[model samples]
Target: MAVQENLLLGAKASKNATLTLVFLSILKGVVGFYSGSASLIADAIHTSLDIFTSLAVWIGLKLSMRGSEEKFPYGYYKADNLVSLFVSIIILFSGVELVREALLNIASPVEIKLQGIALGTAVFSVIAMYALSQYKFKVGKQIDSQALIADALHSYTDVFSSLIVAITIIGSLLGVLWLDSAGVLVISLMIFKLGIGMAKDSILTLMDAWLDKDSIERIRQNVGSIQGVKTVDEIRLRKSGLVVFGEIEIEIEGDASLKRVEMLFEEIEKTVKNEVKNLEHLVVNVKPEKISVMKIAVPVLMQEGLHSKVSRHFSKAPYFIFIELENNDIISWDVSENPAAGLEKKKGLKAAEFLKDQGVNVLIAGEIGEAPFHTLRDNFVKLLQMPEEIEDVEQVVKKVSELNTLTAPTE
Candidate 1:
């Protein structure tokens, strides 16, 4: 339901319960006064307190419906839980009072008349409270309103207490005077139990407990299914009122462009929103996976490690072929004599085939003819043009790292 409609429904329900309880409280109070029944008076007090409880429920629902602000970016969804917590405390206090009164009555029995008026009032209350409880329970469940549910449960307890009151008064008139206090004591204990349960639920919500495992798994599966996503690194979700808030981190290919990554993020958002319902806020963090190093081969004249110069004459015999393994920086380097160096016949073809067999990812060179270039191209080797004058292996490696090219012009 829309926010405004939900708020209106909550207001209507609260108003109905408040008015109904008010009328019943007055009726019970008058009947209790005339009949002089202690149990009726106690029940009247309980009904009267429910008026305030229903009011709390309405206020909580209204507050919870408010939109997020600068100070409260997550909105007021926890207001309902806070109110429920307070209502539980109130119910607990009421139970303590009932227990004290029951003990006192049991210790010093007060002779009081149990008239037909008291019995009629108890029966009337039982029927009225039960009907109201059922209505509130249905509405509360429909809206997923915790405050409303708490109030409904509180009212339902009244139904039981009313029945107990009737039974106790009847038993007292039948000469078992202790039954009156005993029944009140039992009702008080039940109220305490209900209050403890409601408080536990409210506290769990207020603490931002994670949603069920199944719901989190569903979210993970949906987001992880998007194209270009390498993995779902992490996902966390918590319920706030009827809405869910989540944070997700995903890994994607390291080579994905900025635009491609952005598009993947958008897809993740759409996929999750479509699959998961009632998500209020979602924060997505994208991390690119690390790229592995490329092994580059440079045909060169080398006397030492750093003093290597590119061989000016391509396809000619070179003193050394430097294979530079690189990631962010050159992690290591290895030198091997060109096996096809100064070959008598088909020198370029032999050299190209030799480099291809070396499993070279890329070949940096000065110049080479069409035949050898085609052979390297067919072999899926990447070619990068480097200055013949460049003598530093580090400089060639840097150029190889910075440049993304294949089939450089023969210079």
Candidate 2:
């Protein structure tokens, strides 16, 4: 779904939650006021505060949808985090207020009038708030709305608060007047814990903390496996309010043309976004691989050290020598027999795949068929030919080193 639509849905969900809290608060307040139950009154007040927090969520979701990229390049994603912090503060203060009222009542020893209505009202509020909190949590996580989640946490605390009211009312019925006062204290501590946790999460999100390690590693593996990506240099991502923002630096395919590079960039972006959830914006940097030491492959008819004669048929070659040269100096050489020599069909394709796996950048062959020519060229393997007089592998290396655009291959 579009971000605007998602935000609109979030706003709708929060609005509904706010309306529900208003009703629940009213129900609890009327019951607590007549019964003189301080615990019930405190639960009612917490529900009232949830109403305001839910309104904050609605406003924050609306603000997050307003895009001002020209004025604020990062947009208004932080609006949700700000709302989360605000809701947490309200919750914290509510907890403190509840605790104060509870301790004061304990010191003065106020009498609580127990009735069937008080217990029934608290039980009803508990069920209602539980259902509402679950709804908010599901929607919040579905859309990844921080403000909505914070509000959901706030509402969830209401379930516990109402349960405390039920317990206190039962204690009052059992002739323990002081039990109602102590119940509110437990409710206060639970609310305090939840508020602190929520506040810490909101602050970290506002600070643009680094994304989880698993996500980073997933992006690295995905981008690295692309056909045109040589290396994944760096991946940096951080969670904004509802989305993730990041940049990835990668080395482009070997000797890729401009058009090819563009395709690689698109592939990398598509792959990373598909792999990572909520990744809305990504910057891809494609750098060309610097050619320092390049490996060249030569087809030979014999296993002789460096004097193996060039094979007329590429796929039928008995041995292939891989020569690594840096700045035109032979650094190392290894010879391996061509395993595709026995393939009667698709021999050229098999040989090309083998050389490609062997890290051959350029193929020095005497005669290359049409199939292998396109296959090798598509893989960024340079196709070059030796003169008719060059029959040995040593001469082949010398000719390849001096070969340039002047003596390029011809069909």
Candidate 3:
């Protein structure tokens, strides 16, 4: 669901960028043709390429939005990176062509008519480019969208190129033919540099490089803040257009219960999802520490007499006697509770059998019926029988801990 949301946001942004580029390209082309300015014409071509790149981005975003399948379990996220690479190649080729044309015009310059139509068109193009650049910039930040960022760069370059053409047109009206071609050459170089940068970014994303150090640190801090988590072992991040994929490893106590670990992971995942807008994937692994021994308290259920008997027999071992009174009241022998008012067993010997199967070492009670006694003895449970009149449950616990004998006769 999160991935779908991010993809939808990216797609909407891409569509807006595409429409802006198309409109700007048409406006620039009309202005350049009427003015007969070579630089203006070159800017129009660059704007056209922006339109094409935006379309590519839209298609890539759509493809990358697909959910994972058995054949492609990781989804189509790499599609966006590949499309960026394609866009870079297109930009590079267009830049080379523009440079070639500019060099030719430089060698043999053409006179351009600096008419009102041309000047007015350049003004309109400049305004549109600036507006689109700002929009793209704002949307890119909101979505953390790489495609929109690229579109913003394209618009920014268009603004600079349009301004240069405006200057060249003004210079040409004053009879400076060289200025027009020179501006085109400069624009070509800027476009070429942008192309190279986009190519490098695409390749790096395809190679699955980690995200920035600052982002990794931030994720580590957030994950470490979760309760029960001891430390963050590692964080792996990858990008596909606007989406971010993260895999985290956290260290927790070896003896921590599974429920605690799951809760910690859930908290971290939720924090990252809420904090990072474009987070599409998160995987968490908990590594436990090695330990030689683990001490855990095990609960046992038995009647009052059987509890006392086990407590007396295993007096030297650590144990607690739980007595079920007749009224469904759970009175612990470890507490000062009367044996006569012991709680009734809601589930009978079945419950004790279940506890025995769970590896409980001792059972303390006042008395047990024949059926339960035979069951406990068969399961090798050390039953300690308590006095019927004894009211202090705490004393029963101390007595059992001090006496170290077994209720079951020695084989």
| Model 1 alpha-carbon miss at residue 392, Å | 11
All candidates in order of lDDT, best leading? 2, 1, 3
Q: What is the per-residue lDDT of model 3 for residues 56-156, given as tens digits with 9 covering 90 to 100?
A: 77787788778889998878877777877888898888889889989988988777874567777777888888988887777667766666677678778
The deviation in Å at residue 408 for candidate 1 is 29
Every candidate's CA RMSD: 10.0, 10.9, 11.7
Looking at candidate 2, the ten consecutive residues that score lowest on lDDT are 402-411
Which lDDT tens digits does candidate 1 get at residues 1-411? 765566568768988999999999999888877776667777888888899999998888788778889999989877877888988998998888888878888876654474677788899999999999999998887766778889999999999999998997787678777777787788898899999999998898888876367767887888777777888989877767656678899888655576887788778777776755556678888886743666677777765665676675557847545555645577777777776776887778888888878777577776777777888887667787766556676777766656546454463
TM-score between candidate 3 and the true structure: 0.68
Candidate 2 TM-score versus the reference: 0.71
State in Å the error of residue 184, model 3.
0.5
lDDT of each: 0.78, 0.84, 0.69
**Best-performing candidate as measured by lDDT:** 2
Regions more than 4 Å wrong, model 2: 294-411
- Which consecutive 10 residues in model 3 have the weakest lDDT in total? 291-300
**Model 1 clashes, total count:** 0
Q: Write the per-residue lDDT of candidate 2 for residues 230-274, one digit (tens) a residue.
A: 889998887777777889998875675778877887788788878
